[model samples]
Target chain A: MSIRYAILGFLSANPLSGYDLKKLFEESSVFHWSGNNNQVYRTLVELHNEGLVTQEVQQQADYPARKIYTITEKGLAELRQWVLSEPELPQIKSSFLVQLAWADQLEADALDDLLRKYDAEIHDQLIVVQEHKRRSKTSPQRTPREAYLWEAIMDNKILYYETELNWVRTVRETLNEMGKDK
Target chain B: MSIRYAILGFLSANPLSGYDLKKLFEESSVFHWSGNNNQVYRTLVELHNEGLVTQEVQQQADYPARKIYTITEKGLAELRQWVLSEPELPQIKSSFLVQLAWADQLEADALDDLLRKYDAEIHDQLIVVQEHKRRSKTSPQRTPREAYLWEAIMDNKILYYETELNWVRTVRETLNEMGKDK
Candidate 1:
């Protein structure tokens, strides 16, 4: 449902082909909010079926024709309604945390190894988020208000990763201290 | 898959009826990693069918017969294997964040309203997490190591909510300032 609205929200901005939507999602750092290619295409079809969105096929010279999607007025209204509605609590499902929950059964070395591996993964994610932030800032053509909102979203993403990295470090340090006592 | 391992981990500790598992999930702060009653029962059946767990029917005098689920040796092995495996990146899906991403389309007051509503939601979640932490600490019978791991998990959850609440406040403040400027 959120994915449906996310697509509608993007289409409300401009008509876009599936490829264009995917590119926009990646470029705008909305990929996290989007489904994979198949899911996106399927949702577009569903939206068209529901009259929430309309599609037009564009002829190409040599390449295959592209089906462009445009959000209908109903879709725009639904997106706005969703945006104003009570926010659903995001389902938390951290597999890393799940491992940590049961880590007491693991040996200290193994646990330390797990933490370090997770730390590295988070570090990489932090880098990706940083890059996204940079791209968001340098991208031109947005209204000041739009840029402000985009920055706020990017800032939130950046801080989320930074917080995770810090937590990982704290846990690692604790594990190290525990290792010394054993 | 994470839910399966979480259930297996709990069952490895002790046999539990679906009701017991659901209660423990809420009490132990593993609810985020678990599903609802239907999912729990269905997964238990799946596990039983897969020979990873076995169910024993206990006839109750006043209530319906309870099916107590016990993890098989295979289940324990699988749980351990999963815990030791590389952790998958948790997918991020915050409807609040999604709304914020497109919030430039909304009026200042509407955006402010949205942020305030989200803030209240996070506040409620923070209270739930804190209560879960207190219960985790007060509950007895865990070994020192088990307690340590539990504390770490609780700490992660607490910090996550705290960070989110702080971020929400920051966003609201910025929104207010934007409103003032406008």
Candidate 2:
């Protein structure tokens, strides 16, 4: 459902084909569609079927026709409703957390190995997001508020990753203390 | 599959019925099963069929028979492997971020209202997690390392929430500055 709303949000910005939508999501620092690439196409189909979005097929000389999607009046209304609706609190479902909940059985060395690997992955992710932030520029066409909201999304992601990296450091220090006490 | 491991992790501590497992998940600050649930029971069934867990039906007078599940040697091995395995990086998929991407259309008052409501939820959730941390107790039977790992898990959650709450504050301030600029 959230994906549906996101698609509508994108269409509201500009008329885009599924291919263009895929490109937008790929370059997005905020929302990356996970799993199959077809989710975008699937969601677009649903939106079109519901009459929230209209499709206009553009014929090409040397390529297959592309269906361009535009947000309808109903789509814009639905997106507006979703924007002001109370959002769901981000759920706590980190598998790593679930692992730590029972990792008392893991040998100290093994546990440290796991934490180090996890930390490295997070560190790499942080760098990727930082690079994305460095490349982001507000289009002159966007209002100041829209640009700020975009930056806010990026900041939310970056801050959480930074906190995770720092927590990993603390956990490792705790591990070292436990080793010394033994 | 991760929930399957979590259930196995719990069973490794002690045998538990499906009912007991549900209670454990509900009380868990580390992992909360979302949606219609029954995930625990479904996972237990899968584990039992896979020979990773064994169940004993305990019949009682004035009560329905309850099936108690214990992690088999296979389940224990699987859990240990998962503990040492590399963890997947957390995905960035906040619906609020998606909403914000298109929320430039929102009236200034409506946007502020949405931000305030979201902030309150994050604030309340942080308090709930902090209270859970305050009430947590380490069992005497747990080794020092085990206890610290438990604390690390709690610290991980608390720190992330703190970061999120702080991010929300900064976002609201950004909104206010935009208002001033206008």
Candidate 3:
């Protein structure tokens, strides 16, 4: 549902082929669509059907024909409507937390191991988010305001990861304290 | 998929009817399953079919029969496997962020309105998380370690909300700064 709007959002800026959009999404790792590449093509086809986007085939001499997508005025209006709609509080549905809730059944050592593993993963994610922030700075087409909003988005991801890492360590300490009490 | 494991985790603690499971899930709001009540019933059926749970129907004089589900040995084994599985870094997916990415097209005042709306929604969610934390503490069944884990889950939700609120304000200020620059 959101991928459609995001595609339209991307097209609102400039016309892009599926390949170009895919590349944009890759660079957009932090808040990219949940689905893979096929979802992009599939959404483009659906948008074409809905008249939200127009596609033109660009024939290349050496490469196969490429389909370029541009958002129509209708698509822009739709995207605008979405922006003005009520913001649903984004739910943090963490399965790791679920595991923590019921993982009392696991031995303390095993549970601590899980927390350690999660902390390690968060560490790696922070590195990737740094890369995202770096790459995002290179997009010169965005206006100064857009650039600021984009940085805010990156900060959100970084804040989330940092909080998770802190929580993991806190839990680990709690687990150790419990073990010591035993 | 995570919900299935969560149900098994609940059953591992005690046998429960579908209705009872639903109530537990409601109280477990900090990390509750994404699906509605029907998904609980559907998952229970699937678990029974898979021989991971056994269903016993109890007939009452004044009420209809209720199905009680008990996790089988297989279910316990499956839940353990899930707990031991490598943790997946939970992707932070916010369609709000996606909107922020493209919403530079909107008037500055309009974008700030969206951010303010988001801030208000997060405020409301923090209230609910507090209520959930209060309700969670009343459960006498959890061991000390389990209780600690539950509190950590609450902390996780609180931290997320706080971070999001902070980010929203930061973005609003950034918008203001950009407006000044213009």
Candidate 4:
């Protein structure tokens, strides 16, 4: 699915400006997605032309007038149709796999540094997931199901990061034995 | 990193034909990577032209004589430099997440099925992790550090999958209350 669909889906729930959609995406599902700001604005224009969403211009004194988009009935129908359809398998292109693939040709020290950096990244993400979980526990708007689902997703993320950190430590230890520090 | 490096890295280990390289990738660290035959063959030709790899035609009885490639010293140096360099952050673009981001648009039943499928996939992966852990226990060629690292990776996979499965179940239960069935 394209980011266009995501924008439309968000608008389906309530009217939102392009800026609002961007903010919602980052706050709600930042871990699973990333989008170029240009791409989001571009998709919004295309979605408007396609008649899936309509824009209302609101005047503001302190800022520029904003275009707020709401999903049309046709758009809601399309979203439902898209959901019933089977999704294509996502392409997995991971840099970690590439680095490891060529590890045999790499210097011992280089491999150690890569592992160390990777370890740090996982640790940082673990912290983010933990903080997200703690915050969700107190949010009043969250239904019981949404609360539980959010916690499960964050917990899974924490466990995954912890696993990566543990794995990197082991890789670093192996590099030390091979004389990486030297 | 590009698939070009992955192919070159494998040749740096030992001279191997396209078929052999494919098999090695499947069994090696590159197993986590997905490379089609066209990409592998194209990368091999590019490497040969760039003088990063040397190819030789070898005669075989049952199959056609294949061109095997071995990495040149220059290729090894390049791979080494890459390993020492900072790794790019891992970026993912998942259609599954895109679908979930617009989940409000889905029919309750459709959304329920999606959750169920995701849950099943995570469960299946957890089984694979457990099997890997079991195999690592019996392998003697594996160093102590290697065993620990591999196990840590496996444990993380298990945990992540379980966490995802739990999220799916919670989503499904919520959808069920909305009259969605799996």
Q: Each prediction's DockQ?
A: 0.64, 0.72, 0.69, 0.30
Residues A37-99 of candidate 2 have per-residue lDDT tens digits of: 689899889999999999999999999999999999999998889888887777545888777
B41-158: candidate 2 lDDT, tens digit per residue: 8888999999999999999999999999989999999888888777887654578777777889988888888888888888898888788778774221267777777777888888
Colliding pairs, model 2: none
Badly placed stretches (over 4 Å) of model 4 are A23-33, A57-65, A84-93, A104-112, A132-144, A147-151, A170-182, B19-33, B59-65, B92-94, B101-112, B126-163, B166-182
TM-score of 3: 0.94
Arranged by lDDT, best first: 3, 2, 1, 4
Best by lDDT: 3
Model 4, range A97-141, lDDT digits (tens) per residue? Answer: 456545544455666777778778767777876787777632222
Q: Candidate 3 on A1-182: residue-level lDDT in tens?
A: 36888788878888999888887777676545544679889989999999999999999999999999989999999999887777776755678877777788899789889999999999999888888787774243468777777787888888888888888888898789879988
Report the number of the highest-DockQ candidate: 2
Interface RMSD of each: 1.6, 1.5, 1.5, 4.1
Q: What is the DockQ of candidate 2?
A: 0.72
lDDT of 1: 0.78
* Ten residues in sequence with the least summed lDDT for candidate 2 chain B: B135-144
The candidate, 2 or 4, that scores higher on lDDT is 2
RMSD value for candidate 2:
2.1
lDDT of all predictions: 0.78, 0.80, 0.82, 0.64
